[model samples]
Target: MISGIGNIYADEALWRARLHGTRPTETLRRAEVAAILDGAREVMTQALGEGGTSFDALYVNVNGESGYFDRALYVYGREGLPCARCGSPIRREEFMNRSSFSCPRCQPVPRRARP
Candidate 1:
């Protein structure tokens, strides 16, 4: 499940994979799932290299340095900004009490599963 991926990386991975976070896992093709996982791994690896994500003064590393990954983010915290891939504005929605960021044009809402 993609639940434990945290809001930041989840949004980043979804943007990188060009997949909507609302898409049901069971509805995804194996190749598509693989691509998403790969994208997540790639983004996490890059973030790790940059010392991870730091939102404010509360989040800091051992050396009390803030993470630089925030600067490299493409979607998270960029609501109303133009999407990197498409010119459409990035949108932020409330999900599970947290914010979910995505490009409406690039990552349209997945259709609901049939009953």
Candidate 2:
């Protein structure tokens, strides 16, 4: 969800992509993300300009039923499974009935040194 300057929504990309096709290209998706971030930044600027407190925050609802989380998981998931872009396998895992997918070639998971 996104909110700022009296504007709020559960899904910014879903809203922006309404004008275009629901299935947007990666470039278009990136643009939509940028627009949302920019809008929030603009809200902060507006607040600062008015001498009000300006701040930014991020929030996620794991239990949200609006499909936002599912959409994100679908896009970022499918790991080890063939990538739609490069034909790589999309990988996935199940935890408490929740699933996660990602492509190692596209999104390599960072390794942490063992203590």
> Which candidate gets the maximum TM-score versus the true structure?
1
Tens-digit lDDT track of model 1 for 7-111: 777888888888898888888898878878987898777777775444332234323444454466789879999998998999999987888999999899988
lDDT of 2 by residue, 9-83 (tens): 212222222211122233345666666556445434543454333222312333344343344332333345455
Candidate 1: deviation at residue 84, Å?
0.7
The whole-model C-alpha lDDT of candidate 1 against the native structure comes to: 0.78
lDDT of 2: 0.38
**Clash count, predicted structure 1:** 0
Model 2 misplaced regions, further than 4 Å: 1-81, 95-97, 113-115
TM-score of each: 0.83, 0.30
lDDT of candidates 1 onward, in order: 0.78, 0.38
